[model samples]
Target: MRWSALLNPGFLVAFVVLTVSAIGMSAAIRAYGLHLQKLEIHAPGNRQLSALPRETPSWKQIGTDQIMDEDTVKTLGTENYVSRVYIQKNPPAGQEPIALEFHAAYYTGGIDTVPHVPERCMVGGGWLQTKGAQTLALEDVDTSTWIVDAAASGGARGEVYSVRTLPAPYSDAPGTRVRLPFGVAPDKPIHMRISAFGDPKTGKTLYSGYFFIANGGTAASAEQVRTLAFNLTSDYAYYLKVQFSSAGVSSAQELAELSSSLLGELIAEIMRCVPDWTLVESGEYPPDNPRRRTGASN
Candidate 1:
């Protein structure tokens, strides 16, 4: 009776279906798993991902970019990042000098995991998520003349490294470090993500703006980044987050829109430190490629 039941046509058909389903599932897992693919960590010639430009014709960097301890770095999951404030020089009367708080972080390789965006961190840190994250479509930034990188100079291992290695009036051909530097051009439109937080204690509102560049595309939120960073098609993956913080701004979107010119210029310096996605998509610039191209990252 047991053998006859096992050999029944319905039972045999069900067993075959289960067997085929399992085999197909295994094949799909093998093909699409992120762990099965190669991982890459990219940086500028200076080897410090935080070595961005310090000065431009309009603004100058001031204040220390927090000196992170071991625990902080570990919590961040990657040492390659920047968090600095650039104070605008000599503002017009009745207007406060603009303080552009800038930040960038890159994650790849074994450090691969969920990205940490400010919306979550700030709210958890005692700020209210006054407004949900919003996407601000910005005018295109031209880079035909900018992004000409000289060989990387400094090799600082931590956050103590200054944004600039030389004196003012930034030289395109300085004998010193030239990590990331660029000017504004309106051609390549980019998207920015922004969220606002209110500090109950101070009764003040602060805004955090950012965008994610993963693989060869860009996203406005952590949820979107997850999809872009782990898509089945890409063999290598990384997420470069460029963020800005501002206080006294009415809204995060306004802050981003009002500061578009400044942010556009700042992005030029920031992109130099980011990996050129064109080559990454082409499998030309792997982590070990050694040939650095500060190519288009819009």
Candidate 2:
């Protein structure tokens, strides 16, 4: 009688429903496990990551500056980040002054992990974003231009010890660095035109441009970053936010162009110092890589 009651159609149906529901819930929890482990997310040490070179032939690095105070860093809620403010001077007369602020942070929380972006930070600092955000891609760059003469002069005989020894550009000439016109593509990087209204009587029009790179993917909009943030396949997450401002630009268009060129050059130099996403993702440092040690360009 008890066996018959257990095997009744209604009881069997109810048991099946409960079993399926339990299995579905367990799968859902496993799929969204990253969300549960967000609080435990921690980035590797800043020293473990790659760094920018202090000097380049076209641009001389004056010195490094801090992007934020301790208070600000704490407010951002990540200690595994690096901030570098570089004052660089272009040669010929060293007159073209360029200032770059590069801040890279690792966060494993939801898409809203990064609280500071150009839109929020600029407005909070009393600057107004006049132009809508746009995308810019730094592609097909003539990488030969990045290779310094010193490395090229050594020829292919000896092992080059400098990180400044850039990968050969796609050209017929193998050893020589080629000079080409810097071109801008319309994609990827997020750029915004910003202005500040000081005392109305003496208002100042300052220009600002910024972008964010998540893992290795570039996002031109905050929405894009948020959408890309939920990657359960990867164990860790990282983002790089680069911001710079130039004063006395004639127009937002001019500022955008200049910002693109400067940032492209800076990024090229930076790549030499930082490890690739593959290495970072695996949390494994390459052995005998000069860039990993001393953070020097060479």
Candidate 3:
């Protein structure tokens, strides 16, 4: 073809039309494929953790009206989020009571929607993070089995035992190894931190542990959250951020121990009520599935 002929208006229009049509067709195909796969792009209801027993032999729920203020809730994305606060009951006479705060958010977009990392939030509030975010290796126990066994036996409900101890300073030390529970191990969750606002002498100190759960599993890092959200074979896209904090903790080691114990129990409680990923993936509720009974309790 001659160069002048190729530059004709009609020829250029035809070329542009073909290019646009090809791109449009490609996009349409992708969209249709996603639809066929039945990807879950929104928060799923009836998946929130049930109201933990109001009064257990070991701990009693302290009635609290609010977990986060309206502004904080709005900042965390109010589309799908739940928060609860509880206190440890009947501790040794002199020990300060331990307080637990749990917050979970199902972000459809991605991990970026989750907000208020302790490092940032503490600093923003004029509190200094004495220890930066670090991965504390937690014991990998099959929590599903534990829940079933506990429920069946009517033993101490949600009692979890750890074979290993969490180290001090909350850092991934040389001998540290992360235990994989249920063959699902994500990035290491940041260990509870100790933060002080001003002069260490007079400032109040708080110990806190925070982590995220995605697709019925817990992850400690943003990268892990992305991994679960973007899994190709699974359409389960949800993130749950759980945080527990307390004051009057003596040392980081003590706080780490307390956090590990509380986290294990809390995860078990959450998994008991969270929707089963198998049913969610299939997009069908089988009458025989145990998750049907456990998922929508409250």
Q: Sort every candidate by TM-score, greatest first.
A: 1, 3, 2
Measured by TM-score, how close is model 1 to the native structure?
0.70
- Give RMSD (Å) of candidate 1 vs. truth: 8.6
Candidate 2 per-residue C-alpha lDDT over 1-298 given as tens digits, one digit per residue, 9 for 90 to 100: 5888998999999999999999998899766543333222332233322244444434434445455678987887766555654455552374556554445554554545754666677666766666665444434333334432233233322221122233334212233322111111222233443333232334665555555555445555556655544454444444555555555465556556555554545454433323344343334444432334535221
Per-residue lDDT for 170 in model 3? Answer: 26
RMSD (Å) per prediction: 8.6, 10.6, 11.0
lDDT tens digits, residue span 93-153, model 1 = 8998878787778887543487888877798799998887788866533233333232322
Q: Which predicted model would earn the best TM-score?
A: 1
**C-alpha local distance difference test of each model:** 0.63, 0.47, 0.49
lDDT of 1: 0.63
TM-scores for every predicted model: 0.70, 0.58, 0.61
Candidate 2: regions farther than 4 A off: 1-22, 28-50, 62-64, 80-88, 91-112, 137-142, 145-202, 272-275, 279-298
Ranking by lDDT: 1, 3, 2
Segments in model 3 whose C-alpha atoms lie over 4 Å from true places = 1-50, 67-69, 79-84, 90-96, 109-112, 140-202, 232-236, 285-298
The global Cα lDDT (0 to 1) of model 3 is 0.49
Error of 3 at 210 (Å): 1.2
Tens digit per residue, CA lDDT, model 3, 11-82: 999999999999998798665433223234432345444343333333445665355678876776654555
